[model samples]
Target: MNYITCSQGHKSTGGSNFCSTCGEPLQNSNHYLEPTLIGIQPGTRLRDRYIVREMLGQGGFGRTYIAEDTGRFNEKVAIKEFIPSVQGTGALNKAVELFQREAVTLYQLQHSQIPRFWEAFQENSRLFLVEDFIEGRTYESLLNERLRQGRCFSEPEITKLFQDLLPVLSYLHNQGVIHRDISPDNIILSGKTGLPILIDMGAVKQVTVNVATNLQTTSAPRGTSIGKVGYAPDEQIRLGIVAPNSDLYALAVTAIVLMTGKQPEQLLDQYTLTWKWDREINLSLLMTQVLNRMLAPRGDQRFQSADEILSFLGLRQTNPAYSTPNYSGNSTPIYQNPAYSTPNYSGNSAPIYQNPVYPTPNYSGNSAPSPVNNSGCGQIFDASIPVPQEIKGWNWGAFLFGAFWSVGNKVWIGLLCFIPYVGLIMAIILGIKGNEWAWKSRRWASIEAFKANQKTWAVVSLCLTGFVFVIVFLASLGGS
Candidate 1:
């Protein structure tokens, strides 16, 4: 999956002509090209069937690309190149075997949302998997577009989001599959069907993480987080343990972000370990209960399966209230509900869901480039020295305070805000790149320390923004 930065410094998935965040036209130069990491060049032929078109994106796991399959009349497909970080040819060959074996299960999975796995092959000492190419923007982009319009996702759309995606989850889970990484970036709104299609990474990310952990330098942190920092559950993050509910927990996090136009760090209370989003938006009591249960800190406390959630959504014919969904003429995509063909599962309760769709290495090459240095948001991020994914997202403090926020974070590049017109662009850049730049430039004791510093700035920025808004409103009223 490739990524391009828009005028607002928003990093959007590749293959999109417009900015997913700001909806601005993207220049070709803005399409991030890795100044390094030559995995495969364009026009390369593989298996005498698939021809490489261009590299889409890369990550700590591997790189993903778009290719033309000659066997299928040159239909475009996604190709993931897995280069394990481990040393030794014996280990590499064994890893390839595990990868091919895991690909078999993915081949068995047939669903409307999951991209079809074509085949896995090894050529020239490199491993590759061919998959269906989904043409559309990610849910992250869709939500960003909504935010650009001065609003967030409506309750109606979010309800339908669950309605549309839950079945896909049920299908995968019933097949004994668990999607450990589920976030808005991994779920794409298909251009063909307008349905949220899940593009899976399956064992690909597992292979990447396992290999790196064994080969990592002493400076590396203990234990690895497979899912995004905020979206993934605690067990998955702390213990590398995963279950069906892990995916559900992430789905709730995605919903909260889209529903309130706020990220996890902003919504969660570190001290109280509680969500503070009730005042942000008004949701039905039932919906709130579902989210809270799914977001339960402990895995055992949350719903265990997808069907349980479907049933709890008032899916029973006896309950017409939850049966008839509310439509508010909003542009959010709502699909035809799946028939209530319940699957055989033991536990019964409402569970949330999640999977990935970043444009760089999206299990099928679907995430943004993980920055390795003070890399510009528009530039290709290095995979070798990966940056922490936690700090990635909009920084309200950086956006509001402009150059002042830069001075505090020690991201001196942001000080260009002193210039008149450049100040506006600098502010946008700071908001997007501030956290990452600060992480790289300054010496923080830990990720927590770094986030703590920014969170305080974020609170202050919010208050200042609100104060300025009030003053402007009062002045307008007096003039009127």
Candidate 2:
């Protein structure tokens, strides 16, 4: 198949005359292709498996592409082409080694919101990292769409986003992974699940920068570093230092940008290192207080961990009956937990290092460790109120939708589906525990209302599952 990346980053596959995604001309005298990195071209095969489809986007970090993996039954993937802005063959080799090292760590991450990191390889004197391709618009794209409609994300929408995403962040931080980059462009809203999926690990970018700086002969290129100008914190940008809070700073900037439809430069005061975002728009005092602390110029002043942010937002799962402060975003929430105080991470400059090992695809009786510590869940359920026997059954919706369903219903355990190897087992567990978890977590009008909602979800999920099976059947017949 001949492929060419059109000006709009759309690929013309299947010998088409026009681009498949945007209807752009494949070979027109009038229009030219979008400016892409030199060397890597469309239709280029790498590692005898991945067929490059189009250059999705390029950045200071690296060039990203939409590719098809023939080995994975033609599954689409996002491949990052690591182009070190450095000189010398020795330096390039060092960079590749660094890239692989960081890639290994990224590959270990298994969170529902994070795209699965697949493989890291050196091909054609270039380094590439493969990841699951998300079929959705970036938050940046979504924000632009909203701006076009003469509005931006509302306070409540942004609040819900914070609620949805903070747990994912807590999961990453606990796993000793720092995204480094947490801007709107990096957060994609998955079309299939309608959940925000975090993409692009800046650890790769940081590795390139470290190689360039440490290796005396190999001078690092300006753009090869982790910090984005406005999104990055003072310590990250001015000094080469980062912590879990650094990501929180970027996330705050992203929220404000999405809410105000303004750039960080517009919101922040250059001299005082204070944000004037409130001048532009008025938000609830609680939200105002939260964003201010997150956007604080000093790293120590910001929320130390993503768990802290989740705590502040009252999103953590906790026992409702206990007068000892439980997790409830509604019904007079608890702002802080007595156990969770601001962590003093004064000495820790980078992600906490864990013993890295190759993942063996085996399931022990013990389930894969979840990213976020939601142990409070066990205590959340009341002993007196027994689960209704009438509605207790395997949940088709939970089984089918996985984390997508779990997230909506506040069943944190269902997110185990995002775990590296134990996801299938977790899906079955979700089906079994779905009804009980939902009953405890949320406040429904009545048991009837709860049953009705679950029933509706099951119906929709079954219909969608059937539709997918039919598509696969037709495709298999066509191939045969």
Candidate 3:
């Protein structure tokens, strides 16, 4: 009897229209639609390792397939085929080159939140990239499900999401990469961890190199605009200028969509170019401020980095040395009861400051102080209180070196030194209180090490300043 295999590779006894085991359509599975471009037939083995099962989806540049890794216990993987819709041999060659570049870049990324890149190869006159198959529903699907239930995501859910995904964005930014496409469809809520996994590297653009040289040598391919409409910011969609904040803008749009259960087009007014939300939703002012900054129309107006957002939310990177409170024997969790004070890890527990939004971890005397509590406070900085000890309160090094001091210590706020008037003001403020801000922004091994490091930066800045002065003086004398 002639048998038919389903998309999941389950073989039915006879040539039935539907799969016997999976119940998926024999001709076309409900999991994925048929490919529109060039693709491999189901059950075809490529590179003698990956067995293509079905086309997962297709885009302007390529088709993705659900494949099985024959070499690794028949584990499922996704294979991306580089088959751009552009015509001619030249276009195909360029497309292949771009595809290979993307694969190589992706291969180097070893983040837990990103898909694991397995291999990239050319077979049967086609290029393909293999990556770990994430078994989870897309955020798009989750949003749709919520909509069906007639309820949208709550404020706490959105806050938790931001906390989870911001680190992933921070990782990518630190690597000098920008994810040009960041929509709800590209995010997968992991079934195992319940954390968001960023997918679809097709739209990833390198920020450190000349992107035009690689992909837009002649003219950009017809499908070069890689982001979804409304989700992508104005700078990215119209000018093709994608910055780190561009992804944040898209993320903000995704959050709004999740909260409202409405499409981006519905929330945004095309004429005025601003977002609109129902007053009945009742989001806190802090969340409103954060989302507004993230969704700023201009990239410069938005928070430059994910870390900035985290700082605003009063969340800090957990120090590996510090362990969470042990709740082994207690039937009622200590964390659940607000009245219950955190047990002392050491003799000294820092004075507890309750944040209306998130639970603030009580640090012992041995551990570093937690991030500044900005939960109910509207101002970024208040002059009344002394700066936290973790960030050295005041230093002559920061005062003299100014922006240089901030940069050397990874106080990213120093980047604002490039701005005209605002930069001048920031430099002055950093000069006066740069050490305090830097300390709060980053973690240090010890106070002594941090002070020594700042002293060195001050010395360097002084020498550089003298050199510039001498050069200018010599030039002026020669001109006279």
Q: Which candidate gets the maximum lDDT versus the true structure?
A: 2
Q: Give the TM-scores of the predictions, in the order they appear.
A: 0.57, 0.58, 0.57
* Candidate 2 lDDT by residue in tens digits, 389-431: 7668999999998888888887787888998779899888878
Candidate 3 ranges beyond 4 A from true positions: 1-38, 204-224, 278-280, 317-480
* lDDT (CA) per prediction: 0.67, 0.68, 0.63
Task: List RMSD in Å for every model shown.
Answer: 21.7, 26.3, 19.3
Model 3: how far is 199 from its true place, Å? 0.4
* Residues 276-338, model 1: lDDT tens digits: 665477776457657767877676567676666778787423222223223234322211101
In candidate 2, list every pair of residues with a backbone clash. Answer: none
- The alpha-carbon root-mean-square deviation between model 2 and the true structure, to one decimal in Å, is 26.3
True lDDT of residue 428, candidate 1: 92
> What is the per-residue lDDT of model 3 for residues 1-480, given as tens digits with 9 covering 90 to 100?
555444344556554667687787554332222323446789787776777899988765567899999899999998877654443345445555655666655765777778999877754235577888999999899988988989988899888888888888876654445677788899999998788999985343221122333445554322234477998887556545555677888899889889988888888767767666533355765787687678766665677767779898987643222223343332221111111112222323322212222222322324432232222222225555344455445565665565666666667777787778877777777776776666444434345655777777778777887899999999999999
Clashes found in each candidate (C-alpha, N, C closer than 3 A): 24, 0, 1
TM-score of candidate 2 relative to the true fold: 0.58
**What is the Cα-based lDDT of residue 184 in candidate 2?**
94
lDDT of 1: 0.67
Instruction: By TM-score, rank the candidates, best first.
Output: 2, 1, 3
Over 4 Å off in model 2, which ranges?
Answer: 1-39, 214-225, 317-480
